[model samples]
Target: MSSTRQFSFEFFPTKTDAGHEKLMQTAAHLATYNPNYFSCTYGAGGSTRDRTIDTVKHLNDVIKVSTAPHLSCVGDTKADLRQLLTMYKNSGINRLVALRGDLPSGMGMASGELRYANELVEFVRKETDDHFTIAVAAYPEMHPQARNFEEDLRNFATKVKAGANIAITQYFFNADCYFYFVERVRKLGIEIPIVPGIMPITNYTRLARFSDACGAEMPRWVRKQLEAYGDDTKSIKAFGEQVISEMCERLLQGGAPGLHFYTLNQAEPSLAIWENLKLPR
Candidate 1:
């Protein structure tokens, strides 16, 4: 983490060889902009663990960009987690996006050795002794599974206290939610940088589905505008670019530490928003 505002992008491990090659090309394109780091996400229960490690290694060693790999507690034993940690450490990857991952369908709640993100954070610290710069997840609008906002905030505070160095929030359209969340976190004596996650709009149908799944609100006005556009992808993209660009402006101006984009393995959509912001290359 630099004193300067950080900017990063996230990608998921693609399944097929061609898809992985294409993803590497995408990462190479984004690398031109010199993001703070590029992160690769693993599948639930570490289903795509090997692919994640490969993508991260290629991004860091081949593409020559600093890379962080996402690690989750769900569907993994402590030994499983420890082995991955050792592999990452051996590979010279120093940053991590630690999470209490979503349980796969039909998986018992009693799945992983660690139950919560705070516990995972604590485990990482105890295992690594500061070898990694751990970034945890935050929910400005509150986690979908959280019982209430207060409980969610408390959970976040617990993670911070467990030795998370920073947080990346779930994407939200409402800048106000992010500001309000930060305001409250400060009240709880937590001051780590909570970078806002940005999701560029490309396909309305896909975006809507993701929003619903993640419990991120799509403001009525935005939803209506997108619906009106229907299958007009051009208009949808233009409107999306404008809306998200403006929101990013507000977040940065309001003193947000940085942005972490959910790029969905595409370079152009996130790049369109980045170019609009005129961020340093």
Candidate 2:
């Protein structure tokens, strides 16, 4: 494994003051590990646009680390996106995670000015001319809305061709799935770094719920093990750490570019995994 491989963490903008404080502390804690950058997720349909910007700014200003704000095309106008790009540029944020975010429940797809993530990446390049390092989403198991695996791969290639500098995948448990996805994309002539998104298993119920919603496959054995633990929080966390740590080792050994953890605004789970991997801070 390359010692200089990139590592990053993702967060969502918090709605409450307390939540914001907690996230700040979490970011601070993780910063000690020298992650490549921190990413803040934009709310669906641009609902929390202001909060996302504010959170990104706060992390950059306070944590003194490069922060990337997620920019989603759904429910946004070209003018609105232009303004946001300028704002982030002015705030000294030079990285972005471009996404075709989910539409809010009941909002039709036609409501958005931009239709896909490729269009969003194109717009960013046209508007900013490489001022930002653009990162786009990829799915190993296939995006939930995709009609099939080929279509999903093509869509990801479209984003890369549109100027995405990197690709971060949806979190998955199975290492073979990630390796296969990378090999397939390589065959498609997409060479951008595809970083595996890692979700530490802290809460089985919550993890299962999220996995189901996001199309991440939780293997039957893993599911059964988690289910057997029931409400045993300690055992669940220990088992989760062991499972995720081993997965990380395999991914790194298999030549994944790096890891991007879905921190979910917490510190310990991700930190524990980092420690388990014995990665340099």
Candidate 3:
């Protein structure tokens, strides 16, 4: 990896005190690596907006890390988003992951004020005038709901043209998928850094479910191997670290800008992968 490449972790707001405590512990541990930033995810349809803001503030104040809070367009009005942008700017939180997040369960898309992430990016630029560094999502394996690969690439390009400064992809097992996606985007004249998202495979069942839901492909070989480990948590984690670390190595060596880990609010799995790869802290 380039020494100048950026690395970050993603976390979500927790509903319970116990969950909050665990997230804090995890954040403290990962902070040791001195990541470029830590990002807090916004819940579907702005359901956990307040909690997300709280978590972002805690990380910035207590953890003392550059924090990025996700701002989604789903279930929000332009006025609501403008208010949030003002609040975050006043709080010294200048980085944002702009997304058109999933609608809350059973909520229809027609209810949302914004229909796409590109629009959100545009609105942010119009409102803030470069006050924030905006990060947007890239789906290497084509978004599940996209009409086709070409359409997905076009959608991603739109976000970049609308003023996204960076792109973080959905996790995938195959590095080739990331490479192909980057090459296709480059053909569209977009040169923004595209960081690969890494999901450490600590639990096969949960990994499979998340992959299925997000349209990330888990290679059959990897799935069968993980399945063979069955309930052996130790074996699962061991195999996961080795596999993910190797994949990360290839991604970096092949010119990936950096990595963004989907930490699932856990430290050890991602920490192990970092150590296994011998990345500089």
lDDT of 1 by residue, 16-56 (tens): 99999999999999988888999989898888898999999
Positional deviation of residue 67's Cα in model 1 after best superposition, in angstroms:
0.9
lDDT of 2 by residue, 1-281 (tens): 24558899999999999999999998998998888999999887888998998999999999988999999989889999999999899999999999999889988763567899999999999999989999999999999999999999998998899999999999999999999999999999999999999999999999899899999999999999999999999999999999999999999999998999999899899989999989877
State each model's CA lDDT, in order. 0.93, 0.93, 0.93
TM-score of 2: 0.98
Deviation of model 3 at 69, angstroms:
0.6
Off by over 4 Å in 2: 1-3
Instruction: Please report how far candidate 3 places residue 90 from its true position, in Å.
Output: 0.4
Reference-based TM-score of each model: 0.98, 0.98, 0.98
- Model 3 ranges with Cα > 4 A deviation: 1-3
Clashing pairs in 1: none
Q: Estimate, for each residue in 1-281, the C-alpha lDDT of model 3 and write its tens digit.
A: 33679999999999998999899999998998989999999988898999999999999989999899999999899999999999999999989999999878888663567789999999999999999999999999999889999999999999999999999999999999999999999999999999999999899999899899999999899899999999999999999888899999999999998899999999988888888878888
